[model samples]
Target: MHYVNAKGILSNKNGMNLYRGCTHGCIYCDSRSNVYNMDHAFEDIEIKANATELLKKALKNKKEKVMIGTGSMTDPYIPLEKKIQSVRESLELINKYGHGFTCITKSNLVLRDLDLLKEINEKAKVVIQMTLTTYDEDLCKILEPNVCTTKERVKVLKILNKHDIPTVVWLCPILPFINDTEENINGILDYCIDSNVKGIICFGMGMTLREGNREYFYSKLDKQFPGLKEKYIKTYGNNYGIASPNQKELMKIFYKRTNENKIMNNPDEIFEYLHEFPSKDKTKQTTLF
Candidate 1:
């Protein structure tokens, strides 16, 4: 891990990434793509040394209370977070300033800040977003080796639900020829249903492969699943969108299950929910003149 003096912390939309790069060795990570242009190795996490300070300042100066999000390009609950507590500090700032909060993470480390999340939800709102790519515990280990397994993440979701905190699930980057199957999709959906997640965001039944990420993914495929790399090359051949051959059928199951469970499935609608901050205004009392 390394540190840098950052000029700013929050994005135009109030999104924050306390660190750059990641240690979670997910083979299909799109952040590894050269298009992002990271100067350091992906595992050498770049810590924003001034993230909490900048966030404190940003929240203090902001004119309106709005939802502040994180974990877009990098998961805020990465292993380094256990030591730095940057995300936890930022959450304190958000709660202190009466602003809503949300984040997307695959790790169960987020449960550490459950107290602050509840406080923020009571004052404004706190929506926890988790990514569940694979349901099978053994397969989850192979896919996201550095982080906690999917079952542990599900436990986090259930805990948040028990606290009456809303949760959303990002069911994405479904690698073709690997986990694109009815059993896998159904298993994950069952978890979402049981967790009582407010929504499930799934763009499609397949994942994306690009310049830098493609090479890395192919390399991992060769290492973990020998000869599978050749199959991807023969099928995709440098295509950016590697849609699953079973995309149509898998999507059919996705919509059917989410709709049946009353879980929001539309990406746009779910995003709107994530961005919306609750109004804290109380009804004014009337006095007779």
Candidate 2:
């Protein structure tokens, strides 16, 4: 890991990535695409030395309390987070400023900030977004090797639910001819139902492959599942969005299960929920007036 001074922290939409690059070795990581243009190796995490301070300043100057999001290009709970604690510090700042908070992560390390997340939710809103790719534990290990398995992530969701903290699951990147199956979708949906997740965001039943990430993904595919790389090349060729042949079938299951469980399935609606800041404080102030 290397440190670099960041000029700013939060994005125009109140999102921030305290680090660049990731160590989570997920083969289908789109962040590895050359479109992002990272100068360093994907594993060499670039730490934002001033992220917390910048976040503090940003939160202090905000005219209205809005949701602060992180872990988009990089997961905030990456192992490096345990050492640097930038995400933790940012959470403290968000809570201190009474702003809503949300993040997307694949690691169970998010459990470390349970108290702060609970506090933020009680004050405003705090939503935990986790990505679940493969439901099979062994397959999950293969797919998201560096992070916690599906069962562990489900546990985190359940714990958050127990605390009355809303959670959303990103059910995506279902690699074609690999994990795109009824059993896999059903298993993951079962977990979301059991966890009482507020929503499940699934753009489609497949993952994207591009310049940098495509080569890396094929390499891993060759190493882990021999001959599968050739199959992908033959099927997808130069396509960027590698939709699953079973996309329609799998999506049918996804929509059916999520709708049956009353989990929000519309991407737009879920995003609105994530970005919406609670008006409880405003209501309280109005009452006082």
Candidate 3:
């Protein structure tokens, strides 16, 4: 782990990444793509040493309260987070300023901040978004190694649901012939149903592979699935989005299940929901009546 001063903390959309690079080791991690231009090794972990300070200033001076988001570039709950507590500190700032908060992560460590999440949710809105790729435990390990398995994540989701904290699940990157099966989809969807998730975001039954990630994914595929790399080459070539052969069928299953469970299934709808902020206490009251 290392620290570097960042010019700014929040992005144009009010999103911030307290850390750069991730160690979760998701072979299909899109963040590993060269487009992001990460300077350090993927697992080296770069800390924005002043993220909390910058965030405090940004929130303190904001003309209006809005949803503060993070974990789009890297999971904010990585192991280093336990040692550094940057995410927690930033959350404190967001809560202190009466701003809504949301984060996308794949770790159960978010449980540690459940009280803060609940506080924000009560005063404003707090959404906990978790990515669920494979329902099978063993497959989850290979895909998202070094993080808590899907089962543990489900428990966290259920806990949030019990606290009335809205939860969204991202069921994505369904690799062809690996985890695109109906059983896998149903298994994960079942967890969503059981946990009473408010929404689910899935682009499609596919995964994107580019210069950096494609090589790593293919290399891992070669090591674990033998002959899978050749199959991917023959199937996808240099294309980016590799759709599952069962995309149509799997999508049908997804729509049917989500509709029956009353969970938001459209990616656009979920994204819009996450970005929208509640106007609670938006304008300062003149009197303390």
Worst 10 residues of 2 by lDDT: 280-289
Q: Encode model 3's per-residue lDDT on 155-270: one tens digit a residue.
A: 99999999999999989879999999999999999999999999999989999999898889988998889998998899889999889999999999999999998999888778
Name the Cα RMSD for model 2: 3.4
What is the Cα-based TM-score of model 3?
0.96
- For candidate 1, what is the lDDT? 0.91
* Candidate 3 clashes between residue pairs 3 or more apart in a chain or in different chains: none
Q: List the residue pairs that clash in candidate 2.
A: none
Worst 10 residues of 3 by lDDT: 280-289
In model 2, the runs with Cα more than 4 Å from the true position are 281-289
Q: Where's the lowest-lDDT run of ten residues in candidate 1?
A: 280-289
Query: For model 2, how does the per-residue alpha-carbon lDDT over 129-170 read when each residue is reduced to its tens digit?
Result: 999989889988887899889999999999999999999999
